[model samples]
Target: MAAPALGAQEAAAAAHMLSLPAEAFGNDPNVEMVWAVKAYQHAQVYFNLISSVDPKFLKLTKADDQIYSDFRKRFSDLKIDVLDSEDMKSGPAKEKWRPFCLQFDGVVEDFNYGTLLRLDCSRGYTEENTVFATRIQFFAIEIARNREGYNSVVYDSAKEANLGTEVVSSG
Candidate 1:
């Protein structure tokens, strides 16, 4: 965003922006800047929704073959970490996630593309917690978090914040 850009909104005027600056994305060739930006933005939106809105009322996909329930059942059998660390995604650990990632083929957009993911469920994304991973890796972990009640802290904290706001207003 710091780069000079056209004020014009026209496609012809903005044709130069079809690809973003490489420096902004650390020049990861496998991950296009556009895809990474959109993926990150969507991830932020998803976190916001799960934090502000109850997960039970959420709908992720448009009437897939019970993907949510299916994911939970399938993921339950894995003996690996619950998508909490970068160790499980590299070298030998990849075996656990590679097949897992394959299961979500056609289920998630750009499942194999690189993405940023958080290490802890109790906290939002931060430099310390963020990890470079496949899009499927991010979803596989987060979806598991949502179903297993690990993301409850986000919702619970939101409720407490709202209550504090109400108390201040009443006072």
Candidate 2:
């Protein structure tokens, strides 16, 4: 069967994600940047095929055998690794910080794949003194066929907000 068409919202979301600045997501180390690109490419392919079949099934059972095979090969080539997530804390004089480092060592099946990383930090002190909470998210996707490609980064982030709502974000 042929795939269904993308609605207006879906189209717009895809466009937005491609527009976000690489720095806005805090990928300064370079390797992580590459992972982002790879993930985006993988996602694009699945997005295009949404009309064809459910992506969840595609990822697990190889519902889209060709796409699955291609993904496996490409993913194997890109040897992605989390290099570091160092906690930076100083005594009275030093500022506190946490930095995450990652490395991408592999070839992307196509220029379409990319990734997104998000880091959030919150601070709180107990009555006696010291405790803080930090949360980090490293989201990556392999965009296969993004009509707008990287230009849709901003839209993609916005669309992601709709997750669990009316719109759903694809891997």
Candidate 3:
């Protein structure tokens, strides 16, 4: 395959980064720059992993139900609760859920709060979003989400934005 044009690659990277909140980093410029780089690295890792499986998958369709089913099974095998309805409704169950959920600690410091929060704020964390899931779960949900139609809108918008700036050379 031919290499992506430099402008196209930069545009794509810029588009991917638009998900981050600028104001969140307003308190510290150095920290903000660090997080931006970390977030970009994390996103690159994810995109590479997903693309390796099937480059056209995201543009085509969502994975089958079995893919998501297997995701749940993996979570169970890892002893992480799926946080089912009954689990959510009970105080004890909710309390038990903390350990299973992803936490920012020693193991996660490489990614750190700046990067993790970027992913969480945009794609994970909420009930409706996939980021609330642990790393494996997050990957699973995002793979499925991209395959489905959900992620197409962002790219479409990105394309439009890129077009508007194609005339100017940032370099």
Candidate 4:
């Protein structure tokens, strides 16, 4: 029947769309880390671009304010160091950075939940760091701060390595 044929064709298209790219192998240890770093970098660029227009658009709203509040509460509820919005504000440079942990629980039924991860935001003068959060949470907190004109203090550690590179003098 025509309906059966159409359904079969649709299934094939869906599978193709879900297929992974050619280079996604689980052999290397750094692959996941590299992917995460790239994702975070892209998110920063996108967040800056959008925040430049409507600053307050990402702030906690009545309908969904609890989401952000709940996320932060988890830190305190767990007796971990609680870094509120005030802590997120930029501050004077310091000799060392304080590290904090974030707890995340994804929405999907089969997805991992209750994962705690640590992040050091020493480069960024702000005390709060969302590096361990999901992309949505990262954007939410970062955008809210960006809206308030609190610039991100996160500095790239890679720059320090680059700084150590030496050039040979010509004879």
> Which candidate ranks first by lDDT, i.e. highest?
1
In model 2, what lDDT does residue 23 have? 61
Q: Whole-model Cα lDDT per candidate?
A: 0.63, 0.31, 0.41, 0.36
lDDT of 1 at 100: 64
User: Model 4, range 1-171, lDDT digits (tens) per residue?
Assistant: 011222566556534533555366545454444444444444445444443444345443332354444544533332122334333333521111122222223432212211112233222222244434434344334433444344332222333333455332321
> Which candidate achieves the best TM-score against the true structure?
1
Better by TM-score, candidate 2 or 1: 1
Clashing pairs in 1: none
Off by over 4 Å in 2: 1-28, 54-171
- Candidate 1, 50-100: lDDT as tens digits: 889875556565523354456556556643233446455557667765776
**TM-score (all chains, Cα) for each model:** 0.67, 0.21, 0.34, 0.33
Q: Pick the winner on lDDT between candidates 1 and 4.
A: 1
**Over the full model, what C-alpha lDDT does candidate 3 score relative to the true structure?**
0.41
| lDDT, candidate 2, 1-171, per-residue tens | 122354678546545654566566664454443443434443344344443443233332222344334433544333222212222123421122111111222221222232222111111112222212121111221222122143244334445545545544443
Query: Comparing candidate 2 with candidate 3, which one achieves the higher lDDT?
Result: 3
Ranking by lDDT: 1, 3, 4, 2
**Regions more than 4 Å wrong, model 3:** 1-40, 44-66, 69-132, 167-171
Shift of residue 91 alpha carbon in model 3, Å: 6.8
